[model samples]
Target: MSDNPMPSSFDGNPEFKEETAGQKLRRRLREEPLIPLGCAATSYALYRAYRSMKAKDSVELNRMFRARIYAQAFTLLAVVAGGMYYKNERQQRKEFERALEARKQQEKRDAWLRELEIRDKEDRDWRERHAAIEAAAKEAAKGGPRPAPAAAASAMASDQSRTAEAPVEVSEEKKKGGVLDAVKSLLSGGK
Candidate 1:
């Protein structure tokens, strides 16, 4: 085995070496600090102090103290304002997320309802087709005996009669007599 590493084919590829100026700038910016608030606050405080001391009088000391106090107050206010803004932004983000979730749920519900409606319509159509086929079968059966339209009507009537005459078995417990018999026995004298 050789101690030297094998050269990859991509080493000679021109596409790997291609990079635009904008890409390089973006890479540099990404590597830089994101927020420079520390430097900005220090610079602002120093500038305010410099302006406050510029006045040369006994009142200048008072003004400098007041300016310093004002600077402190402003710094505190800015901190508080920034905190409140961030809190409000977070709340707004939560509300937007909730609204998006609710919209998704509503869309899912609507899709389900549409699917159910389509299924119901298909079921109704199937039942209607089945009934028509049954009617046609009956007509054809009757026409086998007599080749007239009246025979089909007679066959339908016969089918209705046969269905009506079919005996329906009722259980002894459900013969509509259990409760009534008990009531009757109670009304009678210990029968």
Candidate 2:
């Protein structure tokens, strides 16, 4: 006879086997049925699904955080650029206002200068006309109607002298030489 043991028919047919040690323990645990083993298995599977969802949520949160940071940076850049542009515009406006004020002041000054110039010209013309009238009056005062040719010539010569108003005769003592006159005389004598 062979020394080998016979192979059982149950080992060849896996579906016809009795409960194992582990299956017996599980059945004993499920006897009270506080929470069935199947329910516990499903709860554990749902917990694993929740953990996967939490991980995906964390990835999305990180992407949102990066986008927020980029948005903040761009907002800061826009604010600074707008502030600079406003400052430049304000300065330009101030310069334009200053130029306008200067132009107004210049126009006022020019108007004043033109007025003074016109007044001065009018004064000069009036003085010239007055002097002409005075000379004609003096000529009419000096003569009778039509003197002799020789007398008329002499009278005309006298009239010329009278018409040219004589320099005011200051006293000789008042007309004493100044320091400049003395120096000029001394220099001329030496020469």
Candidate 3:
């Protein structure tokens, strides 16, 4: 009813006097482009990082970090233990092989010593029997008393073959042929 138009509802509110978000942003970009550009870049980086985040809750984040740490520690421990175990096993195996070799050498020496002892006993026995035979022959040449038949027979019976000085006929083993002959023999079924 008045000559002047009534004031709008927007004009009555003080909140409408404040600059809008888009107006403020445009004024900041136009007035100081470098600072706003730097701020925008930093904000964008933070936004991207937030968007790419896997764990939302602090509890979940802590659990994920703990699990990763535990897995890495376990893997490291297993690698170190495995390496030490292999090294220790190799050392033990080497020691065992060395001990086995020493034992085999000792066994060979023992066998050789036994063989020598047997040879020495045989030689001594043969010498004593030879001396007895020589004495008996000398007594016969000197027309001395003869040995008792029963005693002489009993003494000679145990080793009569060994006491004899007859010529020995040694049979030699046949020499093996080369690979070609062996193959040929095999092809011919051992002929």
Candidate 4:
């Protein structure tokens, strides 16, 4: 009885894996075939040599012994060749992986730099707006004649004292020192 049953068709069974004789042979051959071939040849030659000795045939025994040595040498050479190929493949794969990682890191760094530049530009714009507001305030102070600080405070207090249905926020314009004083301050500045 078979422990594993291979489905006849994949249409009926998704897990079914169908392989033709040639496909199986090619796959097996690609999976390091030389060493196994050497081993088989060596074992057959040794068996033949044993049988020749049993039959009391010295010439056949000598020939089989030589064949066994040649087979072993072939297997050794195959193993060495396979090892070299494996090492070369591994080194190339490692180099490819390293290059891929470096490219990903470079992309990440470029994104970070772009984000930093955007933030810096935003900060620069904000500072320029603030400086312009300060310049306007200074110009207003230099204008003809300005009311005293005490009068200004009194007028602000009177405005706050006005009756209203809801509690209104006071002096919203100068809340964060963003814009000029009075009506001009109310006309500008969001942040």
Candidate 5:
């Protein structure tokens, strides 16, 4: 049979398939056929030798025995050659498998790198927003004119946009004191 299975209506058992003896022989002939032929020849020669012995024919018995030995030798050679062919076939299959596995691993690494790049971008944006807020608070503390209330509302709107899909996870730096501490410092003005 070919390396791939042939689709069929019969999905009964994956391990078993129904086929007549003739069909089986035809399939065998399509793959390493010489070994099967050699085995058949050996079996026939042995059968004839047994028959000749039973008939009390010494000359025919000797000839059949010699034929059986020759057939057995041919079968042995055929088996060794088939083994060598299969070894090469198995090596090729292993190489194909290794290459497939390597490709999958590379895809996984690429995906991980992409995720890291996104996280880095988010972290940079978070830091820039905090720095802008701190600067505004410092200016207000020094008795400068405050930013318009609408500007504060727009900043809040931008924060909400970042959480459109889900809550923004607190990053490593945010986990130290957090946005609450920043808000407190802004309202209290270092007191």
Candidate 6:
């Protein structure tokens, strides 16, 4: 006979094997209800204390004094345990909220980065196309004889002088001051 106990078929399965802390707590609570018992013990101790107080004899007052004290102590411990459990729950909720917010912020940053990358790629493609067009234009211009630097400068100067000497012609409505003239005349009482 083997010293070790035989393993059950269910033991091989992970789902059937291990219990979580919450599950263990639920099982323990179901098996033995302590909190209610503590409350009852406390109430019984208080009643006993009240009875002892009412009793005139010192012997009667001394009866089961230790049991009453023990009951009160257990009740105090139970209340403290409940307070600790509440604090833990609150802390867990706050941590979960903070983590969720951080995840949302991270997702927003990732989306913004993707948008920037797409725009940058489009700009790069446009620049490449523009550079290719400029290169082709230069290659085509190579067939023609280039003008002298001094002649080019003089031609540009003459063009600028011609433009400067010519008077700029305004449209009929623009020269007449359009809506502004009408508004001014109305405001000035036909003056």
Candidate number achieving the greatest lDDT relative to the actual structure: 5
Candidate 2, residue 170: Cα displacement in angstroms equals 35
lDDT per residue, candidate 2, 120-179, as tens digits? 444444565568556656776886344356864575566456434433222421254333
TM-score per candidate, chains pooled: 0.33, 0.31, 0.37, 0.33, 0.40, 0.31
- Candidate 3, residue 23: Cα displacement in angstroms equals 85
Compose the digit string of candidate 3's lDDT tens values, residues 6-92: 234333544333456897678646644554444454455445445445436556555545555555555566556555656854465
Q: Residue 151 of candidate 2: its Cα lDDT?
A: 66
lDDT assessment of candidate 1: 0.52
Question: Taking the tens digit of each residue's C-alpha lDDT, what string does model 4 give over 9-97?
Answer: 32353322345689756864776799889999999999999999999999999999999999999999998988787786546545554
CA lDDT, every prediction? Answer: 0.52, 0.50, 0.54, 0.63, 0.67, 0.57
lDDT of 1 by residue, 106-138 (tens): 677657654544444444445655686577778
| lDDT of model number 2 | 0.50
Q: Could you tell me which residue pairs clash in candidate 1?
A: none
Which residue pairs of candidate 6 clash? none
- Clash number by candidate, in order: 0, 0, 0, 0, 0, 0
Displacement of residue 163 (Cα, Å) in model 6 is: 44
Q: Per-residue lDDT of 1-191 in model 5, one digit per residue for the tens?
A: 53223233223533334456897578657757888888899899889989999999889989989998899899899888877877865465455545546656767755765455445445556787789788889999998889998998798678657735444344643455544445445656956
* Cα lDDT, model 4, residue 56: 99
Stretches of candidate 6 above 4 Å error? 1-85, 144-191
Report the Cα lDDT for residue 116, model 5: 50
Candidate no. 4 TM-score: 0.33
Give the residue spans of candidate 5 off by over 4 A: 1-83, 156-191
Most TM-score-accurate candidate = 5
Segments in model 4 whose C-alpha atoms lie over 4 Å from true places: 1-29, 90-191
